[model samples]
Target: MKLTTCFSTVRTRMVSSQPKYELIQEVGRGSYGVVYEAVVKRTRARVAVKKIRCHSPENVELALREFWALSSIQSQHPNVIHLEECILQRDHLAQRMNHGSSSPLYLELVETSLKGEISFDPCCAYYLWFVTDFCDGGDMNAYLLSRKPSRKTNTSFMLQLGSALAFLHRNQIIHRDLKPDNILISQACTPAGSCEPTLKVADFGLSKVCSTSGLNPEEPASVNKCFLSTACGTDFYMAPEVWEGHYTAKADIFALGVIIWAMVERITFVDVETQKELLGSYVQQGSEIVPLGEALLENPKMELLIPARKKSMNSHMKQLIREMLSANPQERPDAFELELRLVRIACRELDWDT
Candidate 1:
């Protein structure tokens, strides 16, 4: 409880109805809504607030979906965004949190997004707001742009990211969108007395929570029948099975594979539009799309064996990544397995018996 706020009161408004927190600044805006940095009056706890409007039935439903997903995940997953509370009523004309149809969400405050730019886009013409903690360290993509990452640093990132995925999968939740922009970083003290950037998985707009106990993969995929088919997510990182409309939680692991490859080589994953077109062409011609592993190997700069390039890790790590990007979803390891492998890599790098 650091009782200090970020933005000043001259820019903030203290409303009587919601006396506990003060709206500080309009920090960000996206396709869905705008984000605000607010602070609690008594405890002075700073938080991010997603300001959304419920003008139409579609908007209201989207707001409900985001609120449900955010509120549900916060209870069990520490790596996920923490939702403070959902303020279900915000009169658009009046500009205060009164009993209305629109909802605004309160969340933990973090510093930056993976893009490193918090400049408000001013495109929130829709309804509903969602909130989450501010991640100070920025997203992994922005961080990578700032500097090349060492193997150990990237491994730490992979470990944390995998751990987060493990928690979500165990809870029967599937994060359909797992890209660099959705992954955030927070500053934390490591065992070596160093402040390090730890990964926090963000953005659950396209997430899926299985109605059935989502914990077991061995169970019939039709048990809950809810989490069976998901043809959603960024195309470049999407698995083939996902493209075919039959997949499980392993789809996320495929995205993680693309992320790991990018982390190792300091490369941006392929564009979504290109991925879609290529996959679409394959669909039109009834041809099987080639795996991304071939494309990665073909990249001259991403030669996993270039010893001169101290930026990337050894080939064994590349091999692990290949396993993650398997064409068949079943061949891909689960988050738990990936975490174990990352642990082994960490231990080996530290010279501990694994």
Candidate 2:
């Protein structure tokens, strides 16, 4: 068959059995699957479809877990990426065919499309795909890199991020894999706009549902280990407890600290030399420290290379970041406390007249 004919036939066969969604383009790719931009034909709405590479049991379980978790917490908070529906692509259509009974899960996309932008639309016969409110501003990692940071810009982003994390914590969700790549900006806040971006936490692949009531101090370490000892998250963002075979909501706080540092310093923990130095400094100090910010302030090479300034982050922000980055997880503030502090700072900064 010709290329177009083959693609059409495949699309038809795939959509007939599965929920019909128009595949616009590939938006993201990870170890587990490829995420695509699709549209719901019926609603003319945009959605994100994560097609997992069905190879292992662990991958399958994680995919299903994410779906279940998102479904459970769909209405809990506005900042979370809502789970619209779960989809299963036919086993035959998948790259790896399933011989016995098996199924896949499709997640609802959460981004919106832009105006005056036209792409290939399926013929009327095909099923209408779903669309989310597109985030034209892209992921936070990309957003930070694109900016020429100053004290004001760095502080503003940090405060906004803290607010988002606080909201998540209020809902009792710990985003285990908290990093720049997973943070997305709403499409409504675009280039040359004065409006602040509606920051939503995307990719609940590694999230855990904690209790909003309070931490269960009596809960056994084994119980905690059962849920957290898997060593499942990104290496750079992993907290000390995670590395030592224990994890909790505080791990998320630690990650938030790493993220703030990355935004202000425009660096990641992936660099071998930098990671080694930072880890050494953190271990030696035996307490929370903002090594990246300090490094940026001290090194002339770094000062010329990155726009981050230590003076940019006000004392309140610095104190908050240090609390989150506390080496001892017990010393770190819970999401609730962090949110309260962030709100106070925001109110003061914006002069809300409250």
Candidate 3:
């Protein structure tokens, strides 16, 4: 079982000498650093603090990038991580003597990470860190692995995820990594037993801001010119062009498609070995994906997903997934279009007003 719950009762463990916040315990770890739960001394508001040991120049740059990525999108959308502030708390006297400086990030507290990465331990944790809102629902990956969600719950999650991604794409931000691990769930208690699960897209470490100023002045200065050339992100969801070093927002759409497919079908398409094989193929043969529909053929796990697709998929949702995972990035619908499509499907499937 994932580590979650028990954080509220833990005694305060100060990660830094900063008097304003008190640490509760370690909660989760992101792509680059460790995360902890903290309390604001004045208001006693709980928050998640991320700690990074800045030992080198590259580490320093990564810390800044993560800070700015979350900070830049602050208050921009309800579904993004809220960065409270950043701080530089000196490490231990011994460690500080050797390292020379401190680096910690502060953020608003949510319930839990989408992956349920919190376990209330009584022991206090002391580490240099940053803070952000805590997410209660853990992460999408854990939730799906635990159990298949109710149709109603799935609708709510898809709506929030699509809306959040739409908001980001509109702001010209590419969330290079949109896996289940990065999508958090916020469950609100409502009269209907609970308000729909609200998903917060976190871990912007791989995200990039699209800009077009570097191109030749003679050419058009379109923001779309800001193409990413890195072949990053988890394999199962990677788009074809990502391997070729030329991709855009549509690349994210491809990832979203894979995510939604796994979400509804309750299956993990490619295994770790397959991921390595495909990555090797791309590195050696310059080919990323096999072909459309080849996903079911290539991954044995698709046996379950194939049946689920036939039984549960309606025309609209199926069409959307297929289009999003198309071989041609241009053929994929942008986030806005995907959101609209999901909204319509949700309204029809859930019989709720749009």
Candidate 4:
């Protein structure tokens, strides 16, 4: 069967004119919506359903924007969370029935099955639903927190993250929110079902699409000239330009740098007091300008310094990371360059270790 046909069959099985899918339990919650683990009546497919509460115009707009954005670029890459279908609230059913209709559904339907049996009438009317593949491993934030050391991020994980970011940037989409909480792991691992996880970038609620016309290929500047005046990201991951209301794709790059720092150093951005101190030192002491790489390396015992026992990272990796984290947006490497650099490091790491 064709891929589209398979997806269509899955959608029909998951959603109907009546409410057939049973909400097994709550999976996640956010300011915008509550996610539930639901199962389809016909096909018995298990899925994650995100239902956003539309309290205001802004909330509705955010929901619509996210839906459209995901729809527009669905399944562009394996590293991105795929959108199977979007469920718009059925007003007809809402007005006629006392029970509420599903509104603004973002579904990730996984192919896994639980042992429970669900009984539903074939003739009963059901509300419309969105279907998507369910990722059983859960979000990166939960995974990282579950680790024994709490902050021990491995090298392979970082490489996978970099690859996901590269895919997002290639599509001219900037995931404004690139925190650990937004990355999700797939259920499929290794043969023993225990391997380093593969990550997918989720939550496009804060993402912005770059205009192709004004984008400068040579310069690192994006064509998205519309000043994103509204500050919408987490405080710690917010780039300096983001606070200044002059964000571009570079802002996402900045966040990626913070993520890399977190994975390597096993520290939160807010917890890095020494980074703030060093930047402040540059302002106060009137000292000769110090390179960020040198500054970070100098303070080996500093709480915020990225832990590098022997500075094991190769020169290329260091240089790439430095460029990504550059304070000046103009100096930062674009997404393509960042991807190439990361791929090289990942490949080299594998070669050297072998």
Candidate 5:
């Protein structure tokens, strides 16, 4: 349905409507929701607002998961997308609900997520509004592919992404879908055509929070130790274990490895669905180029060329990427160690900041 129908529906439902944000234009669209470039009425600050229609069970679950994952993070990281607020919208008969700890709407949503079904009336139209930081520089895929390959940009991105993943893991959040399309580039405060653009890891609809028991105050439970059975993610970015429906946070690292390696070598493939040339690694199987994870799952002993191309690449960086993409998850370094190793590699590179 068109977004105009959505606004009209809301207008008919509410008697005294006071919208907090003004929608400027439609930014993106997914299966469950539509994202709009909006501006806060009070502060005149730009924000991206995601309006999710909780019409189906799958849509509701995805919306709740995204909300839960984003809301669960108490501390903010520069490299991660920041959630400003969430507003639950119902019919005119019911009151609009602002997200809070004690909101019944939230409790209902949580129960729905756990039960995998909606408890309320199936005909009752409800919506979840997520207000977040607007990225003007667009997604990583677009930003990187539009520019010439540069060591400085690659090093900067590596450090930023490593730090972001470390922060998420420490917070017990695992971003199952980690790819260039999901990662946004924010050029806020930077001048036009500036070299430095802040990376913001976003789209946590498939993310999982790994917070179980068995943890000491001195040393908390590592995210890598938290095993999950959901085989959900882009085919190209999934780890070998993820293909088997059993994996941990290390899967995120493997996905990042694919992105890093592809970025360094400028390897690209056209997405059949979107017809967009996306940066990622793939294995040649006869005439078809299959995902690295699927290829590794079929043959665990297969070795990948770290550099993919006969170009200048740092030995340390190459080795680290290789380890990160190891078929065995145990051999891959955790997010914490990945950050440290990336820093060391960046420091060793003579033209890291060039």
Candidate 6:
């Protein structure tokens, strides 16, 4: 049986007994899955393999969302994570679940997502494997904090992120969760021996694609108009509207603002879950650091003290960030405009050499 998703038709079947990729080492692990550093046995090209066990509805939903979002995007962007392919394994049989294809096992996953819990034989376990590019540098938080602060790195990252967000928005995708940890870095070195890295926005489990249909047939539907009510995102990176249980793509702008602000000032906080210091912006209230979203929700009119840590900051950049993090989503600029502003700021105001 074949299943048609909102994006495309599913077609997949069982593959040969030969293993395509050989696992090398464990790279990372989370609640849903474990990531491995692997390589293709035939070509010996390095790739990151994510093994996700679909044991529950929540896990199935998250896996499908990531698969749908990445597979739906026909043209890949430089700063966005590239999904090479997906393989589904059940018992001793393995099937290649390529984009726009599905099998009985794949359909079973879709049913599990829509119909909640399903019965799986005790001996049979379903696992989905996602193979993608292997980021050598590491996550954004570790990469930036490992080295001394540089305006060149900051400017480059800002431009790259802006471009990425703009591309996603253009494709009508809203990344509900945007944080430093979700952003990966691919290491690179310039001819002048400067540390330059390309940013890849990963983890699309919370991403949503806005519908193209609009109230008016003549007017094109804008991602900004597609409001989402579910309050989902990292606490420190959520926008005020998101905290209130309603927001649009503009929430992404606010999250990006928090990241760029913390990155520029080198502000960090310890993550309660991992007990790791992560770079992110938050509001200080009575000695305790509070989420910026919650603080704004309590007092919408409250003014933020821009450059709270830095003694002096660029006037234009400060203003732009303030607008991006504004309490009102309407006040925040969309991703398209943000990309233009970032480019102008990098070229005119910021000194690349410094």
Which has the greatest TM-score? 6
Task: Report the C-alpha lDDT of model 3 over 1-354, residue by residue, as the tens digit.
Answer: 111221222223333333556778877765467887777767887777777755433344455556656655535677777776554332232111112123222220111112233222223232224567877777787666676557776787788889988888766678888888788777667886855567889877677766536546554333244688877776656777776678787888877877777677665534455341111111111544332223532442332222233465676776787777776777788788889989999877563211
TM-score of model number 1: 0.68
Error of 5 at 106 (Å): 2.6
Each model's lDDT: 0.58, 0.53, 0.60, 0.55, 0.84, 0.85
Q: TM-score for model 2?
A: 0.65
Model 1 residue runs over 4 Å out of place are 1-16, 56-62, 74-76, 90-129, 188-194, 213-227, 269-312, 350-354
Clashes of 5: 0
Candidates ranked by lDDT, best first?
6, 5, 3, 1, 4, 2
Q: Write the per-residue lDDT of candidate 1 for residues 1-354, one digit (tens) a residue.
A: 221222222312322333445778776676566777777677776677776654444344445545556665536455777765554332321122222223222110011112233222224332343446767776777776677557667767778888888877766677888888778777767799898787778877677766643567566233113445747776656766677777778888878887776666665433355341111101111344433533433341233232213544555575677678766566677878888887787666552111
Q: How many residue pairs clash in all the candidates, one count each?
A: 17, 26, 31, 13, 0, 5
Q: Which residue pairs in candidate 6 have backbone atoms (N, alpha carbon, C) closer than 3 angstroms, thus clashing?
A: 10-101, 10-102, 11-101, 11-102, 12-102
Error of 1 at 86 (Å): 1.2
lDDT of 5 by residue, 1-354 (tens): 122222221323232444567789998998878999988767888889898988777887888778878888998999999998666766533333333455665677767877888877776678887889999999999999999998888989999999999999999999999999999998856466555699999999999887665655556566888889989999999999999999999999999999999988889999999899999999987889999999999998999976777665777887898899999999999999999999988887746322
- Whole-model lDDT, candidate 4? 0.55
Model 3 lDDT at residue 327: 69
For candidate 5, the C-alpha RMSD (Å) to the true structure equals 4.0
> lDDT score of model 3?
0.60
Tens digit per residue, CA lDDT, model 4, 199-290: 77888877766545545555433433434665667655666677666667777777777677556544432224334211011111153443
Error of 4 at 256 (Å): 0.8
Model 5, C-alpha of 263: deviation from truth (Å):
0.7
Q: Best lDDT goes to which candidate?
A: 6
TM-score of each prediction: 0.68, 0.65, 0.71, 0.68, 0.90, 0.91
The per-prediction CA RMSD against the true structure, in angstroms, equals 10.0, 11.3, 10.3, 11.3, 4.0, 4.8
